[model samples]
Target: MDPYIRIEHLTRTYVRGTNEIHALNDVSVEIADGEFVALMGPSGSGKTTLLNIVAGIDHATSGAVSIGDQDVLAMSDARKAAWRTRNVGYVFQFYNLMPMLTAYENVELPLLVLPLTRAQRREHAQAALEAVSILTRRDHYPKQLSGGEQQRVAIARAIVTDAKVLVADEPTGNLDAESEQEIMTLLKRLNKELGKTMLMVTHDSAAAAFADRTIRLEKGRLNTKTPETAGA
Candidate 1:
């Protein structure tokens, strides 16, 4: 079977005062459908750049990126924004929840862009919260929740749209050891149970171990290394 996400000769460059910076250099990778993959690298190694490009939040300087049947790099900004609303779910390192919005409200934000009725949005948002085991805290604000709980809420918001792919950038970066373990377990469950294709950028090896395979980026190039063993 073909890969769900295919990237070929992906290069992203920036011109900073006549100095050319290569954030990604001819990087090619394939991620199968429903596969849980981890991306790791040092700071400025293009891990987040790759993730942002794949998530439609950034544009590549050259090369091709195809997610399923769609040519992502070819899409117009408007088209990409529309596609992202329907197909991509992004989980940020910091919970990124609104300061005033309750967990339920935060989870429902994405649906407002769609054609769904308010009732329908509430139903889906509630379901997503339930999936992340955060239904009981739906009325709580982000400040009232623990770090792990806030991350759970963020995960709930990500899946509320029922997007085909989940792009998580350092989802556990702000949590403690115990919370990080809990978040990793939750992510593993999301990939296996919900059939969500996850592309996570993590610095923690233990966090990456939760993924089925780990790919590294060095000096903006893809590195071939033995896949880390998936943790129990």
Candidate 2:
């Protein structure tokens, strides 16, 4: 079967005065449907940059990215934005929840852009919250929820759009050990049971262990060792 996501020689660079910084250098990867992969690296390793490019939030300077059959790099800005809303769901380290919105409202926000009726959106949002086992807390505001609950709500929001690919950046960064485990279990469930492709960037070794495969980066380039070889 064709990979659900593909990156070919992806490179991203930023220029500050005369100095050029390479955020991603010839990074190529392929993720099959329902696979859960972890991106591991220290700061400035370009894991987040790769996620951003894959999510269509940032463009690579050179190379190509394809989500299923669509060439992401070739898409027009408007098309990319629209495609992202439909195909990609993003979970950030900071949660990025709307402060004023209740958990239900936060998850419902994404549906507003779609053609779904209010009742449909509500139904979907509630189901998403339930999937995370936080349906009862939907009425609470972000500030009122614990870190783990807020993260669960964030995950609910990400999936409420029915996105096929979930791109998470340091998703467990702010949570405690138990909460982190809960989040990881939820992510695994999404990949295994829900059939969503997940690409996660994380610094935690235990968290990375949850992935089926782990890719490490150094100086913006893919490391030579595959996870199996590294273990050997």
Candidate 3:
């Protein structure tokens, strides 16, 4: 089968003063549908850059990025934004939940951009909360929940749009050990059970262990390795 996501010769560069820095250097990788993969590297090693490119939030300096048969790198900014709303779900190191909104309302935000009615949006949001096993707390505000519960709500928000791919950057960076384990277990279930393709960038090997494979980067180059070989 073809890769669900393909990135070829991906390069990203930035100019500061007279110096040019390469954030990603001809990086090539493929992620299969329903597979869970982790990306690890030192700070400034292009992990987040690659994720942003895959999520269509940042443009590549040069390369080909295809998800399924769609050419992501070729899309216009407006097109990318539209595609992202439908195809991509992003989770940050920090849970980016709206503090004042209830968990259900926060999950409803993405569906508001679509043509769905208020009743439809509420149904979808409630189902998403159920998927993440947080439906009981749907009416709670972010501040009322614990760190783990907040992350679950954030995950529910990401999946409320029924996005096929989930890109997470340092998702467990702010959680306690127990909470981190809880989140990783939840992510693994999402990938293995719900068939959501996952690409996660994390510094923690224990967190990466939840993925089916682990790929490393150094100096902006792919250092591909299997989970067994990588000690994940």
Among the numbered candidates, top lDDT falls to 1
Write the residue-wise lDDT of candidate 3 on 194-224 in tens digits. Answer: 8999999999989988888888888898875
| Reference-based lDDT, residue 148, model 2 | 91
Total clashing pairs in model 3 = 0
| Residues 53-87 of candidate 2: C-alpha lDDT, one tens digit per residue | 99999989999999888899898899898889889
For model 2, state the Cα shift of residue 167 in Å.
Answer: 0.7
lDDT of 3: 0.91
Which pairs clash (backbone N, Cα, C closer than 3 Å) in model 3?
none
Decoy 1 TM-score against native = 0.96
Distance from true position, residue 215, model 3, in Å? 0.5
C-alpha lDDT values of all predictions: 0.92, 0.91, 0.91
Off by over 4 Å in 3: 224-232
**Cα RMSD to the true fold for all candidates:** 1.4, 1.8, 1.7
Off by over 4 Å in 2: 226-232
After superposition of all CA atoms, the RMSD between model 2 and the true structure is 1.8
TM-score of candidate 2 relative to the true fold: 0.96
TM-score of 3: 0.95
